[model samples]
Target: MTELRHRGPAETDLQAADDFRGLDKDGAPDGDAHSDSEAKGDTGLPDVPVPPDDTPQVLNKALSGLSSRWKNWWVRGILTLAMISFFFFIIYLGPMVLMMIVLCVQIKCFQEIITIGYSVYHSYHLPWFRTLSWYFLLCVNYFFYGETVTDYFFTLVQREEPLRILSKYHRFISFALYLTGFCMFVLSLVKKHYRLQFYMFGWTHVTLLIVVTQSHLIIHNLFEGMIWFIVPISCVICNDIMAYMFGFFFGRTPLIKLSPKKTWEGFVGGFFSTVVFGILLSYVMAGYRYFVCPVEFNSDSNSFTVDCQPSELFQLQEYPLPAVLQSLTGWATVHMYPFQIHSIALSAFASIVGPFGGFFASGFKRAFKIKDFANTIPGHGGIMDRFDCQYLMATFVNVYIASFIRGPNPSKVIQQLLALRLDQQLQIFNSLKAHLTERGLLPANEVAA
Candidate 1:
């Protein structure tokens, strides 16, 4: 009896030790075997979602014979070529069309992002949320485009009494409209859903900041010169393409945790390729009056025109090579447009820093467990996906111009002077004439007049 009792207690002690170690009585894992494998496989990051097959039936049928991987490649390639072709067509259509396209794209991108918020928060049934979001969009657009119209089309605004009045009170009107939306939002807030409603309120404003504000800057860049808009944008596109090609073929090492597929090899290749592309693209565009000239509104024609003498930056100038480069290349001087040097700066930013915008969008989508912002574009995702980097580039170009490139615009000053009362205009004219005469710049006869 004593021997049996000792063995029983000893066995109980062993059983308790096994339980402490998370093992069953049989000396195996206590839980599901698959759960152990899952713990082993946990990466502390979300799995990258596979893109859905949203291609058209016709294209789908054509690609049906191929494997899924090859089919995706072909679909992306064809759509990419088509988008590029359409882009060229719009550029040919002129600035007005381009501005309209930008507006449309802004609206579409806003919708895609807002729709995602709706899905994530289950706010479809929420009162006044969607309406207020769009109201805010309208209010912001009015404020931005209103300022643009006043700045660029001031002559037209002056001729129309209503537009003139609106231009003068644009800011006040924008604020009033936004205030009305705010009041409505407060009224719409529910007791149980207060937190979610506030979350969505923040989401809407951030979306506006991202979409509308950057787009406004893009329009400003366009007005400076189409080159300001196009070159930066093309640099981003070129970098995107080159990086993808290099990564697809040569990438072995990962570059970032946010985007697993990105690689250092692709990043380096894209940088060099984009720099060369920017230089050549700038060379071609610099030679053209249409591409280099600032967009202006002609009062007589009542339409926009881009016709100005090529700026010195566009003209070819001889630059002396550094001693190191001179000896290596057997060249004393190199003839190139000054703008090409600027292009190197733009291209470097586009290639090196621009990808972060895309990475940010990636993180956002991952947080929401979404594959893409929307299925608006087959094989490419949404308009936001394509233009995320472009928006960042636009802001950079705008700041660059204001800081380094923009000078006193004589014509703009003249337009502002013309908009003043007759007496005020005369006062300014007299002041300028007096200053110029003192400096011996005004002719003797003209100064007397």
Candidate 2:
């Protein structure tokens, strides 16, 4: 009985040791299996964790531990709302502030793009690249801004003797400045890095073409009318937001390889939502002269004004309905703003073509293997990232204006005439009178005067 008892205790100890070892082995595999399942779940989507540098100051590290999806939504929503609020505030502040904002955005975008080029070509140690890029930017800005000032604020230009002289020789001065930069770039080129220097030269010029030129067009749109800027921009913003909302909920089929998360469902949903939003926003803005009137400097007020009579595009007009629609709705006509009709075109472009701009940026970034252009805006990548579609929309608006909306500016013509030499002005005046007389548009008495 004593021997049996001793054997039983030893058997129990052996069994306990085996169980302990088994638990260690089995537990390890179980943990590994759970991790494998998680990795499998995340196979398609990239692990885009927020970098330490890009994280917001408001968000504590503890909050950063939240799931990526939640963090994205939180950051995106907060920034979007803040941006919208700031947009309205700027609008209320008036056109001057808006112009300043556009200028700042342009400079920032230029910096971001130039910085990219610097980083990419840094290996070659190209000399004076950054300086040449900035010099070119300055040259371009001077040329464009001078033209804009001469065109839109002729009164102010004429009142100031220095500005008048500058405006008179603006193009020549701009050319001289650009030539100087070109000479400097050429002088700075080293024999060893000639190819690298030339490559960077092309890069700088292309970046200027994309960033500066498009931004100049945006300024033109803003001057034509606030509506030209606000409506198109709002359409893009609405589309971007709705696309995300739709995609988050119902996205399945990938839209493009460049942007895998983009889906056909989101694209379609954004289109309809943007169209509706554009039309409604246009309708409301049409009623406000502040939104519809072209920006003009007022010497008397010593400030800019949006006080001109609203253009025909902003006017309300009634159109007779088709017979089928009239029968169905019992209405013979519908009143609508022509600008609202144009908004459809704007929204359509913003919806259809605008996203391509974003895709192109995405492809460019992927080529460089960079996540975002710069961490300018939290959760939104950078200013360049947000404004990619906007730049495209701005170009469209400028083209549309030139094609359909722009008319001969009497003030601009008069300013040009006034800038001429006295003899030249008199000769042109006489020629105009003679032409008018031949057409029987000028009375003999007025012609003599």
Candidate 3:
């Protein structure tokens, strides 16, 4: 509650503002330059000073001044912490529940992405359309992640030995959820102002978003521990910060045509900085040597270990090794060059993809010809503006790791958790699941087995 309140006037419920069209105070046409107050009736209310449609770059030179770099870093810090904390909490909370919460955030974000353009390019009872479309997008987002969630549920059910009977019944279960959702999309067509474009395009984005984001989480969880799940999120936020820090402090070179306020100096600075920090983090975690053993490779036999205790188990003391080891594990080493190599690889991919997502959002704003996604944040723009990099980066990380390397799984985790009782051991599984839930890990409901 304190955290909610601390956000202040900048903290209007974006869900509430989803339908908002950002009208001016006189309640007149945004394009109309004149007002009735000038000619005749003057109300007691003071006129709200609307910023000009043609805003000059560096709207506040003082704000954007080198001295103001600290201010930019400050805002960046808050946003970075917010994104990190939110990602950390959500990833463990329970995948279905985290996704549902993401559904609402996505609605706000996707709506702002479209409406920033709407605000500048077109006009009507836009507030109504914006609001209606927001709920419509909410449904679309709900359907998108809901599809994943529902599919995941059936996938779980279908995996069971008993439920394997439903294997032939897969289509009956899987397709049904989306079919029902598609019908809901059809029902929304009653709002004549809404074109199928909104529903189709909107659903497309939400679906891609879930696939991309979920893959990122799964990949990170595979190799590194929970902290690496924030890799993409941290990179995106750091990109914003170091870019701001460099742009505000030493912004001499403009990078490209998309965002002129952004500088090359800032972009490179943030990119390398994030990689440095991320690799450092990876190295630090490596010190604890979380995984007890390495994936065994038999050089002489050219075969893999048959740890058929379960192929799922990552570690087995019984697995043989020659004096010349295949890989390193709990026997910790600084191993900076190799670890840094991995971090750089991951961060470089993210840095490029992250900014592309931002440019995508910026171009989106241009298509709408709007200034900011929405005035949800005073210095920042909208939730989408903030999360755009994160959205794209998550997808990128997922694809990258999936294409390159496979990470550890829970059976291996279970092997490690064996230090505890079978009952206590299962709590480790609970922790893994907490990643996808909403309650944000409520101490395991009294540590049930």
Candidate 4:
């Protein structure tokens, strides 16, 4: 009261005025604005406010001493070696474990992508979107798993009556389950958020297309042979590491705008390194039946075995050298695995085209104004981040195998035969018998029997 005679306002009133001035025109505090700033800070965005020097340690002292770029490279190298070792261990463990790993990776990737959608569209409070997303994932998985089981384990499925029934109407059942989820989604849509709901629907489908579809192809590649799964993946890993190393040491010209750190130097270095690594790895893997042979169910052992005679693709052959090389090398041809030739294509794509997948992911992150997909892999971002290029590579390998490598699968044909009705089966059996008899491929007694 002694000094209030001349004071314009009390301290509390001045503080309230400052707070009011900080708010938006709607009179609500700009909490979202501050939240964004904090998120940027957490993600290490350059413009965000940095913590004070007195702030407590967040990272380990050993890691904290290194610059961010060095820390990223160091962490990536360690993770890469660990992952490579883990992959070999899984391969040794068998196809079932490898299939489970693929499934786990697919689920994690789908989760990361769908989580992004939820974050972006969360304010609209779209009903049943998450449920519908997971439901569709389940439905698609059922459809894919059913197809896989029918193709690879038809005998096992037929031995069990319940499984045989389920296998018969698998597609119809999957459709029905998906339709139920679709109906629930439709019923949950709010009138006010109709546009947002539809937008999220598209988002969910796109995510499925990108993540689940590619992952399914990866599984198909795995079943084709461990080489199909391993070589391409290893090539990609080699390219990634070599590219990073080259870029860190001598990157000058930028390769792409989306990923600023990518350099032409890195790209070229990675390509050569990947091709060499792929060929060498293919040579080594081709020697082992475990890597070169397709996975097949062994009913006697009740376990999968990679015991088929190695395909011509996996066998060593002498490829004739070109005129110029023949003169220089004093050799007409070089002995090498045919699979090694295919590995070149795989490695080339991993270098040339696979990077686009990473760029696409980068652009997506930029559009969303986020740093990493998620902090799922420390310093490496998410599993999605690591596998983005791998997925693209997997799709290419699957297509390549279908186009140039794969022949009619005998087991798949048997599965189709088993699916036929009794009348249809007899018709095919008689027609085949007649054709074989006419061609003199079957004995008269055998045909009659």
In candidate 3, how many Å is residue 427 off?
Answer: 35
lDDT of 1 by residue, 390-414 (tens): 8889899999999999998777788
Worst 10 residues of 2 by lDDT: 42-51
Per-residue lDDT tens digits for candidate 2, residues 1-449, read: 13223444334334223322332223443334444534443211122333345666776464678898888887888889999999999999988789899989999998987887776455345578888899999999999999889888998999899998998899999999999999999899776556556767888899989988998898999999899999999999999999998998899989998898999999999999999999999999999999998999888998888989887888999989999999999999999999988999999999999999999999777544568888888888879999989999999999999998899988779877887799999999899999999899988888767
lDDT of each: 0.84, 0.83, 0.50, 0.79
- Arrange candidates by TM-score, descending: 1, 2, 4, 3
lDDT (Cα, 0-100) at 370 in candidate 4: 64
Taking all chains together, each candidate's TM-score versus the true structure is 0.85, 0.84, 0.52, 0.84
**440 in model 2: Cα distance from truth in Å?**
3.3
What local lDDT does model 3 show for residue 165? 49
lDDT of 1: 0.84
RMSD, candidate 4, Å? 9.4
The reply for model 3, stretches above 4 Å from the true place, is: 1-104, 114-228, 287-340, 407-449
TM-score of 3: 0.52
- Screening candidate 2 with a backbone cut-off below 3 angstroms (N, C-alpha, C), the clashing residue pairs are none
Q: Considering only N, C-alpha and C atoms within 3 Å, which residue pairs clash in candidate 4?
A: none
**Cα distance off (Å), candidate 3, residue 217:** 6.4
RMSD of 1: 11.1
Model 4 poorest 10 in a row by lDDT: 42-51
**Please, what are the lDDT tens digits per residue for candidate 3 over residues 1-449?**
23323433223233112213333344554235223423432322112223343322444443455455465455545555766687667755633344356556655666654443343213223233344444444444444433432232333433356645444444565466556555655554433334322533454455445433444344333333333444555666766777777777788999876687888888888888888777766555444323212223233564422122321222222334433453644332333434345567767866666788788777655433455666565456667677777666666666665565445555445334654578886776676667634465545554452
Minimal lDDT window, size 10, model 3: 306-315
Greater TM-score among 2 and 4 belongs to: 2
